[model samples]
Target: MPSNSGRRRAGADRSPEPRRKPFWRRALRAIFVWGFALALLGAIFLGSAVYMTARELPTFADLKSSQNGQMIVVRARDGTELVSLGPSYGRWMPYGQIPQVMKDAMVSVEDRRFRQHFGVDPIGMVRSVMVRVETGRWKQGGSTITQQLARTIFLNNNRTFGRKVREGVLALALESKFSKDQILELYLNKVYFGGGAYGIDAASRKFFGHPAAGLSTPEAAIIAGLVKAPSNYSPTADVKAAIARGEVVLGVMAENGVIDPSEAAAIDLSTVKIAKEGNQNSVRYFTDWALPQLDLLLPETSEPLEVWTTLDVGMQQTATSAVKANVPGGAQGALVSMDRDGAVLAMVGGTDYVNSNYNRATNAVRQPGSAWKLFVYLAALEAGYKPDDKVHDEPVTIEGWSPHNSGGTFAGEIDVRSAFAYSKNTVAASLGNEVGFGTVAAMARRFGITTPITTVPSMVLGTSDVRLIDMTRAFAAVSAGGTSIEPYGIVKVETTGGKLLYQHRSTRGQVLVPPHVAAGITDLLQSAVAIGTGRAAQIGRPVAGKTGTTTSNKDGWFLGFSSGITTGVWMGRDDAKAVPGLQGGRAPAQAFAAFMRYAVKNRPVEKFDTELKLPEWQLEPDDEYMMGNPDDYYYVDENGNMIEPGTADGAARTGPASGPPRYEDGSEGPGTAGAPPPAASEDFLDRATGRGNQPDPGLRAAPRPGTAGPASGQRPPTVTRPPTVTRGQAAPVASRPSAAAGAPN
Candidate 1:
């Protein structure tokens, strides 16, 4: 409001007196701003210098494509390649060769400023900082393609200011070192797509089974979105979220003018491409077990290598489905399958490998129970007892220790066929004693029983321990006719360039049983499936198997074989706790049944062994072999003829209609011996009557062989004529036990 004249005077007066904010003040501000800018620029330059140099550090392999430019072909046993893995070069092209749709998709999803920035966008950093500042926390990165490439090829895993600075410097260096096109090409080719895949090419092939260059609009968008966070965009690991991310990326590409708005709108984001196959076909257990066995030959320690194994992808699928169907829910189990020569064809450790770490097939060692009877009976057969031979069901004791049948009862008397077919515990126990605990133990060892065994009489009852892998291999020995072989997983390893570096094949050795004997045993095991405890395992084709259930029903196991494959299954609680009333004939046998059902479904059905037969036996009881009080019945006779009618101390040896033989001639015959004269010694009578170790009054001669076994699924009880028995002594039975209701028939 004062006048212009006054204002002019005031201005003139001020101008002349002061340059108060003189040279020093102005100079300070200029220096401060320029100094800060120079320092920032300098820091970036120093970091870029350090990072670009890091690329030449030979550190590329760490994050580079595994198999490093190589492709691994997983082949089935029959030489069928199941999968081919490598870069998807055809489906994926450099950023230049990509369709505008793909470019837009990538630009929209990753960094809209990708085209304008000098390898990075400071704007992105500032925005990221703003976001973090608003949230009062830092949770994001502002990495550009160049920065990612530098990190991929050189940097260790660290998230810090120094690392980011280095990243920017390296990005700029890379831009200087290579053309933008080349840098983009490498970046597209080097990004990881989660699931052990690297580069768009590999990822495309892994996800789509095609080259990346051929990617469709939606596919391109999805893959482009993955560039932002490959794992986050993984459809295999998570599909809904991945698809949502792709849509957002397409929008960005349209906004950035990388693609036409209409094209961006047409890009599909409703669904994502899914993996054609799971990495291991869901048979994690078998694969894991096979992994260690691979070291047997490849020795990963010797050199970096791969081994080509004989796994059949189809068979693996079969095994996985079978496990899920057969093994009880909330229950865990393991299955191991192998070829006759011990080449592991398929293995599955548990129902859901992603959720379970327990490997019931190999890691868990549970009792095989009646399954152990196979070994017991085999030992008997090896000891010269025929499958049809007779064995006493009378009470027997080994060092005052009595072994009871699984159901805690005796069959009174039976032949080996009845004993095995019915899974009678008493006869098995008797055969175990006769075969000698050493014999059964030896047989198990030859078949690769890794667990230690005690020579307790119970060993005759299959009390030893074994793993599923070893059990399958041992059972395979039976199928292969006595050739013991090792199981292996890896088959051959080659460089991505096709240079063979390692290979593995099974090694075989002749074990204890003869081929014929093994074949014979297999024949009986087939009966076990067809007419015995393993009835559930009787597949459409010929199968031989044995089922075992542990005491208290804690564990269940089944071992069986077809012409081409042998498998073992174990079911139990992880903590070694009882599973209530679970038994071998339940879960394990069922799993075996389920596995064979599919394993043989699409494959050729073959007979177990074309050349095996059950042999006949003739029984003759051995009195000396009686389990208790060996001297209660036999003594020297006056005539030294060992007469049945003779007695000790000049008294006649006899019982009331117990046996009726007072032969003047030494000819042999069978039946209830006609009661002989009473033995002179009432002491023998007292011993017989006291505990009545004497044969049960209910004991009687059984019908002859041809008359008995054919009636029931079981063999006849045996009653054999003893060798010149005086009053009390009988010789060991010959060949096999006789079939009879109460005697060797």
Candidate 2:
């Protein structure tokens, strides 16, 4: 103001020294200038990031199509819908059709300032930051409903700062492009709920068996609660947890004034009825088993697929009923049924699928007991041994291990067929020794026993753990005339648009065993079911199978085939505890019969390719005769008189020795008196085959059945033979008893 010249010098001096600016004012000016410049730079950076992010956003049309696409649908062989996998969408509910209460509940619980915010809520963001700072953990999210929609549509749920920035820009763009109602509608239709359901309508129908338009307030609260964690809060997963979360949502609604506090308090959540399809229906086991195969058969694609499986609903129900009806309480059971071509027809994983989802049929691995003899005997047959080949059934010890028969008394000597029929442990062990353990393991591998098999003596006694499916598949191969087959549940896979992804075609199977070998194996199985330990499995029509009881009765198995279906049953405690009365011949055999009777009811009766001609032999002999005392092997008559062999009275005595004789006068035995009750013949036969003190070091605990065994390239332990010892001082007597017990018909 005082500038001009010398004249101004005086004026300037008089002008209060040019009115010197205050320090505070100067500092304020500098701060404002720098802040403006920094803000402009920040705006430019933010603008550049937004531009880059916008380019990555999907077109609106793409979003709409993705929301409308269906998930994979699985159907049974009869075109019955089994299950829907992946993100399953229901018919879209329009914005107007969405319930007001549902909207209010979501807004109140997820974001209270949803209406006031443009894309992000500043107040909510500050609150969330403060809470995180105070608690050192994220307690609240600052995202508005539009922001959530943006993230769902265009961004993954990543927590990186870059992702957050992208989410914010997309949210702003969405807010500018669409109305609040449209944003909410998209969110409701696109959000995922548990159990493969997407969108509010599908969630409502899946959880409550109704449409979203019909949702009650409590149901709306429950569905709103699912947004945070769909799986954890899903009603099907835990109804109590879902209801508790719903109560939280109700409380939030009340605090936000979206609902009357009294009304929120009075809401009856106890009456919620979850859909039964999610809880019951054991056929889900089959669906679960078959779902993974889709990945193997087809290329990955986002389009929804339609899968047709080999499941027979009728057979599945029958098998389920049979397993439930016969399995003893406190013990679990599993069953698998397949056709000759390895098409899995029915599978029951556990006694109650609702209580437990473990698929025992394909997953659980347990010792097969005598059921493993199938491989041993098959190896014997492959080694040129006939059904009538002589095998000693006496107490024979190998490498310090002595295997005993079920009653602890050997049958002395019998044909391979008779030994198999009676499930003689010594005979199986001897056969395993005769045909090398490696050969036995190779035979098992060839027949689809993919589990680790240590070439040890006990493996022949079913000591090697195996899955029920593998055993059933092996039996199926035999039923298919020795053709190798890989069990398959999926029949075909196609897109909903009818584009074929995969189709199962019946190819000529590799001949695993010669047809005559299978026929011979069938002959042995027939004799087993006809008069052997598996007699409980006999149906009127011809059937073949084997009975297996593991060590300590920990597992019981019955693998059999009738007509064209092969079924295997396994019963045991999951913890490997012995059930006193559990045996392959009792529960498992009975269950097999119950299922097969219905499984084969409609199929025409078909005889086995080979006739059942079992060798004539008695399974039990008198103690004296077994002890090498043929001269003293006499039968006592009704009058207490000794009868010689071939006598008229002795003709009736052709059957096995009942026991030590009881005289007409009530006296005890043939020996003078008090022969110490003659060491009561071992009455029960459920003993393990190889009884020894040495455990195989190479045998690790068997892995879960369906999983891989040892690490790749690992070799099984080498087989070492031990010295053999015979039990009695008297040599084994190969004499055939005069008794002519008829062969199995």
Candidate 3:
């Protein structure tokens, strides 16, 4: 019985393994449950995002009717429209009216699968992400055309996960609501194409000066390329860049079969006729200067505004022409003109607007050269020295810095007026030392010089860099009879509907210099043009000015003014290299004269003294180091010989009254002076002023023994000595130079 029971137990144990379940079936069941849960979660998250985004989405009607807010239409004071800014739009055309080539180019370059995608292109997004990850840079973007339109019309460009999610959701919503052509039309209408163009129609008009229907393949390609980086690829900014980008777009079109390779190749970028808006190109600098003011007045706009600027079209043209006329080939020039009230009438930032748009007149920082001496002289006047007061014009050493004249020639002693007129470096440095460099700099800053001025002796010679517009404004302060002039362009701004938003009245400000002090400066500057380095700028209507030539002729300038206006001209290589023989008296002065002649033609002739009377002041005694009277500095003969001072006419009158011999070296010595000065020089100085009695050229005339220098048949020099003085108080007469005394001024 025991053996039978054991056998039964063994049988029961062996029979138990019969009905076990398979391992693979349980594993498959577990995977199915997890997969279903994950799919449900993803669907729920996507639905929630879409529902949230949809709640904020606008209807098609709202999208179509939306506006980008008010634009600014800048007009000259004369009511001539200079430019229109702020989402400049063209006539919106239906999608059917757009050229097939343009549509193809846009789709190929911006979104290749535009017609196939529902909202966002999955392939494009993955490719963009992969590229970014592989290259560690966002070299390409993935937004489909619809998504771009959605972001542009309804969202900001912020790079955030929420914004991106919103963009994607909105793109999908738009796709569901509109047809592909409708979506493409909206995209083309809302996208920015640079140069104040928004939408394909506007871009076509802005770049090609025509409607979208008239767009050629190349032109369409150019506009299509601008979607990548509008400002960088704008045809107006860099035509070559725009063309290069267009080539890329054309390549894409050819690859996508939108256009045949031969057709794309046949499209020449040069054949694209870019329409030039005269007003926008001409006063581009004025617009740039006015935009900041526009922002300040209407930082956030809801409607288009009409801004009246102080630009005078005639003056603007004159400024552009003058710069082009005088700036040497391969050199850059800038000119700025402002009325006595500091209304900026004209600004020429570069030689040619097409070549460059850099507003050098307002933005470039260069050494003012002797033009900075105005501050030094003004400071001296403030420090109890009159224009007639004498100063030693010998070499000066200040803290181991010795300053000499351009040619190392020193005029022993000269009056303040003569020193300034002659632009004597030694005298300016010495005088700046006598007063303080801080005093000179403070005086300069008082007149609207924004550039940093170091408290060094050399600063007196304008070693500090300064903006041409600022310098012009500084002179404008003097021209305005001591009233501080805030150089401004925008005079009034209002809604296009004529609702007043902001208005700039010609308000007079606190006088920086006393009327009398400014008059003194005015007189000195007048004498500068009458008998100084700035003689080339004489405009016959009692102008006052200064000439500036930096070391090695790296920069040349003429800052000058009449009672009605102040103008500054700067000429130099963009690289700051010296131009052969460039000087303040040559190109810059001539440019200033040419610009002023045209700028003030309609204005009446006015005198500084009429506006500001001279203040009653006593003359101070000259320093012991000084040796002559204010009017006794120098008088030259036709032979370029310095005649000893003591003549009935105030100065020795030995030179012929006509065209005196022109000297190559700017000094009063014999050096190839028999020939007439370069026709360029003579014509430059004489043509604009219309005065027969222009001051002698900065260079002296060579003498013909007993016969006066060659005659050109002009009026005698009208500029006379300040006043006659006694022997000790008499201005030092220029002595005949001994051999080996020739030097360049």
Candidate 4:
């Protein structure tokens, strides 16, 4: 073989002679492969960037101002606004208003390396990775202060891969354009503290009732800790938890030299002081009025906007004070006061708006017990019945039921005026039966008592449920001479800078009885205040109203109206549990009295004009039109016996009370002289004692359809003569008359 150099030269010559491939061709092939791979990666990156940046852009307001927000003042009058601040300012605060110490604490706790590495802290990422490796768990995060700031200001609002990449990019861009301080300031001012607070300033004020700059070291630490979780570690919630979190923050601050160990230890950890029950909002009750107004004013899905209510702060305070003082202990209370035009002036839904959102004035629906009688009386008046109309006060039964007075004793006889002032259940029920339940329900709707009026005999006795505001407005209608106007809270909704976004125009109309008829009812209602169930609500002012107390005392309500103010009050438990021994004449009446005493203290006391002052309730001969016992109100036509409408009621046809029959068996019976009623129902032994297959009328087969005989008679069941064989009750069914003939109880 040749030498190495000689062999290479000979090999080169031989290869060239054999038509060697072109150098550019191989280079082009390699370049093409590299370009293809790089292009593929570039496309992937471009697609990712485009997708991330293309997320739907939010409107200017949608992100910054959407909230279930309303402005309200519990008290207001004449067009003047008292508690003016409502939903506005993006977060209810400005950046300059924030405290420096709070900002410092946040910086120390959230991102200590905020000053270094642009937006994304490189050191933090490295440290987190190291910790994760050392701890064998992913317990740390790589997000920098700038990333969090971007999330607060504007970001994907999501936790997806695309959002994360975009967040990273935005953070880097922000750091490039803005200083670390600017981003940090923005974060501090824009973050939410949850309970309706958007920034540190608002959070501090809402929790401590003071500016954030006023916070002490421990307070600042607690606030800083709240940055991670507001509602959870709120000092107002769990004091121990808040202190524990504050201590953790103090440790961090000490570790970072933000504070010395001695200084940290000196910090007081005496928890944040809130209202104890709930957030202290000035326009609490006005919220009840404004919310409905907003729904009507705003479009179904309009841009975010704030609703400024026309609530007077002083009035609201007075109303709350009144409720607090007059409401029975262990009983929840609510009050509503409005101006002549139905503008809400003062309201206290409950003891605290923050702890409970029940909104008794607006949302609570309790039985209007006797107050419901107002509508029935109004119906009767509208149907040509007079206040002096003679009504019966004797035992009478409906289809199968009968009503009794509150004291379980008849008044012997009385007129509509006397019956109304006393809130007689039997009298009110009689009025309902006469006017018809449907008519009463319809009339109630006109006065803003829009809830359904159930169909039942006792329903006429005010067994219907109605809200405080609704009842208040209904009574307000009576005060306004039957002009029904819907209650309103917001006079107009405006922007933070005073731009009028919406202006409400509320008008009153007539939905039921004429104004004159309403006047008659008003006369009696005023009498109730003078001397009746509503005596507690008497303000020495000429006013008209009704007092309501439900069975078992579940609710107490007083709806009354004066010349300048129309108010309603309710007292009960949040759980709807019956308040032992509480009635409308007590707590609710007292609450109404207190509110009216303060609210109308400076107003004039005016007298109302009564349509009819005649005492036409003179003793009249028996007639069918009389209220209670038809026989007492009606008589025969002349000839031995004859009648038209009188016969329609079988009770009136029954002859004079027949003395107990002279039994051939000489056995005693019920209703006999000096003897009590047959012990059939009272004595369980009569039912339990086995008297050898004696036919227990209760056990007798129920009536078959269409046939009418003593056996299986076509009559309904009842309380006094309930089927003993069935369950729950025992009575001598054999001697009991048909339930359809009359009410058992």
Q: List candidate 3 stretches off by more than 4 Å.
A: 1-42, 48-62, 265-270, 610-745
Where does candidate 2 have its weakest 10-residue lDDT segment? 682-691
lDDT of predicted model 2? 0.75
- Number of the candidate with higher TM-score, 2 or 4: 2
For model 3, the local distance difference test gives 0.72
**Model 4 residue 433 lDDT score:** 63
Best by TM-score: 3
How far residue 337's Cα lies from its native spot in candidate 3, in Å, is: 1.6
Using lDDT, give the best candidate's number.
2
TM-score of 3: 0.77
Candidate lDDT (C-alpha), each: 0.61, 0.75, 0.72, 0.63
Give per-model TM-scores.
0.53, 0.74, 0.77, 0.62
Q: What lDDT tens digits, residue by residue, belong to model 2 across residues 694-739?
A: 2221112233334544344332232122224444432222222111
Checking candidate 2 for backbone clashes, the offending pairs are 399-722, 406-685
TM-score of 2: 0.74
